[model samples]
Target: MSTPTAGQLALADRIAHGGPAPVAAISHVAAAAYTDPARWAAEKTALFDRLPQVIAPSALLPRPNTAVPHDGFGKPLLITRDADGRAHVFMNVCRHRGTRLVEGMEAQYAPRLVCPYHAWSYALDGKLVGLPRADSFPGLDKTSYGLVELPSRETSGLIWFAFATDADFTAASAVGPDFDAFGLGGLHLFRRHTHDVAANWKLIMDAFLESYHVQRLHAGTIGPFFKDGVTAADKIGPHQRSAVGRVAELAALPPGDWPALRAAVTFAYQLFPATVIVVSPDYVNLMVLMPRGHDRVLVEDFMLIPEAPATEKARDHWQHSWDLLDTGVFGGEDFRAATLGQQGLESGAIEWLTLGTLESGVRHFHEEIESRLNTG
Candidate 1:
């Protein structure tokens, strides 16, 4: 395991000393932020489209010549790793007649992607390599007819792609070192599941931004493992990193024991706009949230383990962990809360949602969103 970063160590120290978590004055967010179509449209343009969004964990395409179709952003996209191990994000449209090229969500190993409509094959690098019946068309330049690609960067074991060609990725790239410290790049992807929830994407994001709801919302599941209202958080550019855990247990560990410190804490990162990465004791969960509409969001959740299970016993252990998270904690608790919150807000009973001090992260998140939407 990689050593904990300085920020992680500082968080551990604050928790050990019973230091208060960062707090913000009470704030209110208009209920329409989650329901207004006009607001949603602006957010999609200024936040989601104009920013670099996390496509997937590096482990998703583990090797060369691997490809996967991604439509989470409502834009058909093909994620491919060429023979040289370079990752590319293409428009998933064939140059010939603008036909959709790939079909499913599952990743497949293929040297070339062939369009079902016409058998025009493209190399993994988005180059038109072969086509049938060259005589069928005159003045057809294979060089000019290739897959449409978006700007993409693979760093710190994650793949990030931008919808706008000139989107600045500096804020997104800042999280790389922290992810590297968690050894996220080399982890094994054990399972992936997609969730369609009837809630605004930010509603789902708000659930993970604070520890205020853990003990109450997840009381029946993983809540007992955390200290009530005892959390530490920091902002990395627009991103937020929050940590909650067995503070007393961590305080008992000897000094400079980085591994022990990590094992005692649960670090959750909200990669501004949509993605959330939860670093658990033995595994990590990467969530890519795609907003389908004002009231719906699609979450692609991935469970990554230390390595591929080598034995039945190991598999069982990882399976249990996955079940506890995928089904018990996240699906049943966090997401459920978001759905309920959305329902209540849409009822028009409240015009403003209040944020307490413990939920300062939530306030900070909305502030960041407002800053961008207003400036744009």
Candidate 2:
């Protein structure tokens, strides 16, 4: 379909109220950029390869009865608590010669992780404890041989880590004034889910950008609230927040609460890499899109509600909201398959693809990708 010109967006707002949304037309962007192998190669090296894949240490917040995934390569990483009730993230590796320090699911709040490789060990704080044959490496200074430590922090109900090695972490992460202003930490963990999808990482982000697909892809469910051509966009840091107001909430909104009504209206935050943070009046859904490769991506969806619903009635209330989202936005299998098939275009199969202006959100996404790749 041909994309609409920039001029059509204003009209799209009106069409979403009643008329059909015309196909989008995009300029100042190109389709090959999102699909090109050469460009993809450049992306991996230029920006992504240079950026650290680690998160802040504090992001490992587990629910009262839940355990965070602490998978690691060196010394099995351990995330547990001590008697003091403080949470900690530590390496499960031995201090002697890089042996794994701990194994298995639950290691008690032990002060030290003993290495079975040579009976060498490390304190829970990562200090070198002992070497069964301490004289074997006599000149070795045990203090300098502690397990590799990582920098970390916790915020907004999630743990954030700096995967990059001493790379001025403060500037690399996206936590700052804007996030504080939004008061993201106020929300609580509610629910979570995981989905393995067949598409480029960006395709997952694109799935939530424009409301245009709702009328067609989700005609029976979420369609009534969102329509083609009706949405707004704003970018902060590396995150983009797009929103479309819903009419369903208006019906029950208590008298004269304009501010609350506005707050209840939309889904926001399409953060970089692959994280979609949906903020609603009742709950918060944070979706992490982890790229497996150029064509395979996995989405980890975590819902943070005002509180976890232990009762069935409360659970249903939370499910009702996400049920619409699951079948509607999360159901992008067919769309992704189509994009993947386009990979054949590189083989002289097709000359070019198109983008509609109404779908400029997609264009904006590519522009951001291009900017990062080129500048990095």
Candidate 3:
């Protein structure tokens, strides 16, 4: 399988959930998509430059609620559900004279966005409602002077927004597997932490696709359980699935444990670009890595339980699992080394980070990025 056929390659690409190539000896060349800054900028500007299709609309959340801060056009946005209960996302800035509209997260849940600078006020839906100096702009239409509204909202219990004008706007559909495959949709946000890792976002994503690092990078903790091979792979569409496990967890495991843990588990369904759901028997975790730029990456980690995990101890156990994962994920000196690699990229580092023969998960990810960037 030195050069896996295109169909086989595509299958493997989807199965390992777009991880780099696996160790079955099958091989293929994966195009590197992030090496060019111009392309990266184009992706950021074209895909994330307008309304985020996944970010829910203001009308989605429960009423008597204030718009939570979410990513919109690379800025922190606030959506307020007014007395009428209509949800609206407004720039945290004031429209009058270019002043910031809102200052902090949910501050006072103000009836309307009012500029503390000069006391100019706008309705929750971004309509200009009042101003101290009403006479200042005699002809300015309040309707035309509302706050800046970025296309966004909640969908399937997750915060998604669009900033890309050229996007397909079918983010939900683009996410390959339905909500069921990721075992999400009903999962609420149970935990969150952001990491400002110093690496290209693509690097961060690439790092997650393969298990090669587990052997050395996570040896002490989780490395021993999950081996270096992928158990199975499947692609339902844009979403890819991989079943992975370890010898210790699987030895003598009953066939019934397959859903949660039968010595193996469905590693996750990767929604290309930046979303992954790793499911275990007791809980599920969502890992969202958003690129801030070439050197700044934000990894927002979330944990959720299917039905409260049957007991507090079980819940604690799941949290402990995440703790274990988070530790191993951030553990060791890999991050520092990664920074060095990034620096080397500027040093005219090797043109391409070799995909090696075994890291198929990474190759899949890399290939998809290329598809997104080059597809007509």
Task: Go through the candidates in order and give each one's C-alpha lDDT.
Answer: 0.89, 0.55, 0.57
Identify the leading candidate in terms of lDDT.
1
Ranking by lDDT: 1, 3, 2
Candidate 3 — what's its lDDT? 0.57
Q: List TM-scores for all candidates, in order.
A: 0.96, 0.69, 0.71
Q: List RMSD in Å for every model shown.
A: 1.5, 7.6, 7.0
Model 2 agreement with the true structure over 139-220: per-residue lDDT tens digits: 9998898767655544434444444455343433453333343355555555555666656666667766666666776666
Give a tens-digit lDDT track for model 1, residues 1-376: 5766788888778877867545558899999999898899999999888899998999999999999999999989999999999999999999998999988889989999999999999999999999999899789989999899999999988999999999888987888889889888899999999889999999999988888887788888887777443688888899999787666787799988878877888899999889999998789999999999999999999999999999999999999988999888888788888899899999999999999888898999999999999899
Error of 2 at 68 (Å): 3.5
Question: How many clashes does the backbone of model 1 have?
Answer: 0
